[model samples]
Target: MLKEFYPYEYARNVFAIDYKKLAQMGYTGLIFDVDNTLVHHGDDSTPKVDSFFAWLHKLGFKTILLSDNEKSRVERFNKNIRTQYICDAGKPDPKGFLKAVELLGEPKDKVVCIGDQIVTDIKGANNAGLASILVHFIRLPGEKHIGKRRYIEYFVMWTWKHRRKYRHRLGDILRSGK
Candidate 1:
């Protein structure tokens, strides 16, 4: 049961991810969480994000935004990045993740999901049989429900960091295909 929440890889944030190496690993698709993963809650895309998306494209990745946010929020954030997206996605349910995989036309094993929350993003990707990359939230959300989830995420991350198995797993992921 506890294993269901465990992410396949963990990183500080999206910028820290080694996309080039992932490409070499035969990963062809990337599904990203919009809110805290790409930017702070309710914020628009930054120059860094713009460049990163371009870089992903140049590297031949099929990228898509899979967010739980409403269409307005997702649309606003996507104005500059301009990737395909599914708004108001019911994550932690695998449906959204599966849809994302279908959108990329990539096999389950060739796709990766990147997000800041385990309860939703990580679990959803795992349920969809995709590799999940757990990134720390760029900034904590101000919403009551999301803020509450942040606390639980902190505890889970704390425990995850303390475990020897997780340490080895993290090391392996970082060194994979290098």
Candidate 2:
């Protein structure tokens, strides 16, 4: 499933993505997950995400935020980001991704869906016939309510370990201040 493919294996968080690099790879559109992706789950407000969105636009990669959370939550987060978004995305189902493609008028071959959770992001993207990425969630301190999800995520990552060979290789360049 998730472990057999390289595209599903080596994804870092949406923000850490190299849009220019992706453009080189012929990807022209991006779909992102919110919450711990663009901001801490508890924060509600997106921080520093504006700059990244701006950069994505300049690089010619249209972005869309997709989340299973309610419409209000997605709408609130999209306020300052200036990007299209879908709420109650029911991710892992391919509906949201399909909707996004329709909205962007872009083909699956030129689209890459980026998110943190494998069950949600990867599966949804794969089902939609789009390239997928599973990125580690942002680390925050003293957060609660993520209790069982951590275990579930661990299991996914455990399975995902099989594709480590194709995982994100830009780690060095990304951390080197690129």
Candidate 3:
């Protein structure tokens, strides 16, 4: 059902997330998708990304990079950030998400997964019983040729946006810092 694809929160970008609020909400562990969630596909970590991880560490949150890409790709992006990482994660399967929870040593109720895709990220989180935050995906050049999955995702997103109960008021969290 579409409920499985619903994210607990939605943010425009990783940088736009209100981590303080998430921490206050008792989310001590963060599982993040690399491509399109933290940076463009196949891109290295930006200085901003590095700083963000540093900030998260300072806030006492355990973080990990979870990617469907191969080990080399995940390693390259995580080189500077140095968070724990799991590659070839086989997402939307729940196994990887559960593995991340184990690796973080955090309770399921205290962890969250953040990613750009509903099919992989949100569904996997839901299946694993972890909270999820969805970020708009970064588009690649020649994106139209990528696949038809984006179209389906767009339809799902439209439906999600129209449902107020499923939407998280992230703006208020960002503004009030609560």
Candidate 4:
């Protein structure tokens, strides 16, 4: 079950990855998960977002933002980023990932996802068959709301923080290219 989980999904603090390096990696597309991955959760917007989006735009690679949040929330970011945004994505579901892939206009083998959580962003990226890169959370936990998924959130954070213990398996999977 955990095999379907994504170890990446983070836009920050991920394994050594440079955006421009995608060309060398042969990746033509990039996928992002908003909320805690790109900006502080519940913040409704990002600081210096124009520059961040600008970097992606300058990369010449297509970018997409995938989120489980409602369309309105994703729309809030549409104006800032020069890419397609998919909301109500229900990560680990692969629907949004597929949509992003479809919108990317590139081969799936050349796309990667960046997000903060395992159950959602990371898991979804794995199921969607994209390279996963985990990043540290941009917001504090209090930013998350009180809900059932909150438990899952805690569990994922535990796994991420302890990833060093299980990292070898993750490395094998990523390297195997299966």
Best by TM-score: 3
* lDDT leader: 3
lDDT for residue 177 in candidate 4, whole number 0-100: 18
Q: lDDT per prediction?
A: 0.85, 0.71, 0.88, 0.69
* Residue 9, model 1: Cα distance from true site in angstroms: 1.2
lDDT of 3 by residue, 51-145 (tens): 99999999999999999999999999999999999999999999999999999999998998999999999999999998888888977677766
| Model 2 residue 108 lDDT score | 78
Put the candidates in lDDT order, highest first. Answer: 3, 1, 2, 4
Q: Estimate candidate 2's alpha-carbon lDDT, on a 0 to 1 scale.
A: 0.71
- Where in model 2 is the C-alpha error above 4 Å? 1-7, 164-178
35-78, model 2: which lDDT tens digit per residue?
Answer: 77778664555456877788788888888888899888888778
- For model 4, residues 1-178, the per-residue Cα lDDT tens digits are 5556636433334333566656566778878888877776755655466577777677787888888888777787666665688888877898789889999898998888888777777777877777777666675656544557556766765675576653532233232111
Ranking by TM-score: 3, 1, 2, 4
| Deviation in Å, model 3, residue 174 alpha carbon | 4.1
Off by over 4 Å in 3: 140-146, 169-178
Q: Backbone clashes in each candidate structure, one number apiece?
A: 0, 0, 0, 7
RMSD of each: 3.6, 3.1, 2.7, 5.6
Q: Could you tell me which 10 consecutive residues in candidate 3 have the lowest summed lDDT?
A: 169-178
